[model samples]
Target: MRAFLLLLFVFLTLGAAPARAQQPTPTRVIEALYDQLSAYQLRRYQPDSGYQLLTLPSTFSGPELAALRLRERQLVRVDLVYSAYRFDPKFSQRQLNIDRLRNLDERLPGLLMDPSITWNLIEQTGCTTPDECQQYFHGFVLYIEKRYTKADTKAEIGRLTARLNATEKKIERIRAVRKSPGKPLACGYPHVEDKLRKLTKRIKKAYDCTQKDRRPRTVTFQAEVSRQGKVLNVRLPAVDSAGAAAPPCPEELTGAIAEGLAFTDGFLLGKQRLPFTVTGRLSLPLRPQQGFKVTGYYLADSLMRKYRVKLLRDGCQARQLRPGDATEEDPIPNPDPNVVTRVLERHPDWQKQTVVADVTGSMYPYTADLLIWLQLAAAGPEKTFVFFNDGDDLPDKQKRLGQTGGLYDARTNDYGRIRQRVIEAMGAGGGGDAPENDCEALLRAHQLAPEAQDIILVADNHTFPRDTKLLEGTRLPVKIILCGVTDHINPKYLALARRYGYSLHTLDTDLTNLSELPDNQITIIEGVRYQTTPGGFRRVSGRAE
Candidate 1:
């Protein structure tokens, strides 16, 4: 009686089944060779010759696996099977798949590195893992693609080299621009400096006797003034030196000081129309006889000046501020609440996850949100992140779908390093076009962390993926966390989700059934009507309320 036949290694050893004529001994070389073969299969392709598959009898082992070398051909898939007569007979499909996956995983690295191969072995089916995939009786399959000619390959390498060089130069240029401290604004008018001094004096007087605590207190305010001398915006620091929230000043005092600063004239300026910011810190007196002390720095024409305060018995007086060493002009903005944290918190199962985030200019808030999550979350070695900034400032015309290469990777528990990576990617490039190389970034991220079970993609809902066509090549389950979405979901994301069966996570809800929705079926999300299509979802009405 013949037993059930399954692919690769199996436990099906029941009654008698015809075994292959010869049984070969298993060796580590064969395992390593299989690993190498799998490595080839995981590579990205440029539409070369297609992949091929080969199956061998479980009994047909030994050096045969290691001896495989096609002259110009690539081995994309390889399977090892167990002879039915020798192994245990009653093996379920689940166990069989699990065994096969284990075998494949045992040799994953060789497959990931080999450029000659091209097929995502782990994601060969709709399911990414063996546990979730349905197993069927099938022979081994190898997929391959033809490579470029010798001359073409050389030329392609040269082109890529030049592109890489150009991208590096672009990044350097961005760094230089950000690091430059411009020439100081030449404010020739002496009276303008006098007005700034008097303004601080009035601010100190307003804050006098305001605090309930008798001890010394420091009140700080940052204000931006246009070149024309008009006070633009005034804000108190959210937090002080000790990490405590800055105590709020009386509204009346704040209003009075703002008005006083606005009325002061003679803000001399240059040809460039940039705002000069003032950061003032007023230290209240420690003793009854002592006066309030006010000292701070202001940037005028890219030059920094430190105001000197002299304490008097009655009240401190302000005088000319000496020119101080230049520093970054603007204070860092406070981090705004974002949806990335909210979405991730709701899904606690996203463990050992690889995060791929867009670090473009508009997505800075979301990027900060990710950092906040990392800082506050439990510490561990499991977190891995990839930050991509749409090609390192590459010009729109020069960027290709899969090659738009501004991707930075970090795998560590240190939140600071992850933050630095985000800043480097952001400073290098902040996407030129409205559409970003989202799929390209994701694919690279997958390569960076193939073993990661959950891939969390933090994307911009407003920007569609420039490389949406490449989505099919990725072999992981991607949970897209969309930021900056307002009334309606971007139809492009919906389309990708629909075709690929991805779940879309927004600030409030998750659309997991997009892929399973029947064609032309209507559904409502957040008061928005959408109809499912074969390709993706289409909005049937206007923006959602």
Candidate 2:
């Protein structure tokens, strides 16, 4: 039993030893290092290599193991030192420290050491994602060395320079692929160049065929390009291009070409082709038209009936009523002075008379009363009444023209009161000092009272050079009766009256009684009569007499 027990124990011990020896020691060490490195990578501060040294397998022995442990320790030291330096490489004394670290192999005393051993340890760490690991490792080293290094520090630079260059080359390759011609086929499409060529040929053919004669014409057509770069349907909207106002070939051709060029094989596999319609306009030079130059005119009889004046070959002539014979009371058979004098002699009682008044500034109250008299005259007398001076109704200078000086007369009629007001207004100088422009005032009054038959200006004739157009159209006879102070009348005012066919009557200072003037002259139109037949006959006729 003792021998069996001893043998069993030996067998068990030997079996276990072989199994342990066959185990993946290197893999376990590497995994343990990876875990430690991962922890260091994730930390805010770099970890010391002394702690990583514990991960080595106990079976690892002698110089090889020592060298491996030493190399790992140096790597860990490098990581921590790089991390610390990278944090703030600008710190003073950092340059001296980095130079000392870089010369580690030379500075170390008698221990077989290589500065590159630390770098090789990092590279051999078996990173599953090596690129990312290398980036972090190289970036930490570069960042640490940058502050102390000059611009020419290429030797001290990290592996990041090479990695960055490799990344840039990869990007260039991708861009080249994107720009490559016919690469659209990678997305399953036909070459755009091929479709464009076919479309150009078809368009040229259609254009030539549709516009055979070259006469101006319009055409309209519908077309569709298939996803396979084929022209599917091309037809005119009309039966042919002949009936079209403009040709459709150009637009149809353009649309077909565009659709073809835009076609892709990707569209061909799906539903890419779409129907498109086009229209075209063609123009040709046109000849000018030669037509009649029609004109219009006023017919002879039509113009004769419409206008009182007649159009002669040279100019217009007035239509006149011819007198059959002369009679005794035929006043002024002609407008001629001799005819007028002869008519006046035939009717001895016939007389041309005028009544005038002033109505400027303070004379307005007197003028209102005078208007009543004038209205009466207008209603009864056959003669005309004339007024002078700016009335109260004149624009821009309108004002009351009379005052009684705090006196009143209840028994006075309108005319009586007016006469009194006139006397008072005249005593006040009647606006003689009120910037009176006699010529402009008369011309303005003539325009305002255009319906009046005769004018009897009573101003002091203070201003001259009146506008003459106011009297140019007066057909009814006019008269001027000067009132108020003498020496106020000028030849210009008299000439204005004569210009408008008026007879002047001067009521020079001595006229105290107003009734001395003819009643017919003071009153308005009362009656008028004319014989229908000319003969030596007895007749008496009257209207509104």
Clashes of each: 30, 21
The sequence of per-residue lDDT tens digits that candidate 2 reaches over residues 421-499 is: 4434333332322223333434433455555544444443323322233345544443343332122233344445434
Against the hidden true structure, what lDDT does model 1 obtain? 0.54
Q: Please state every model's RMSD to the true fold in angstroms.
A: 19.3, 61.1
Question: Residue 202: error of model 1 in Å?
Answer: 84
Report residue 40 deviation for candidate 1 (angstroms): 49
Runs in model 1 deviating more than 4 A are 1-336, 542-545
TM-score of each: 0.39, 0.19
lDDT of 2 at 90: 61
Best by lDDT: 1
Q: What's the C-alpha lDDT at position 22 in model 2?
A: 28
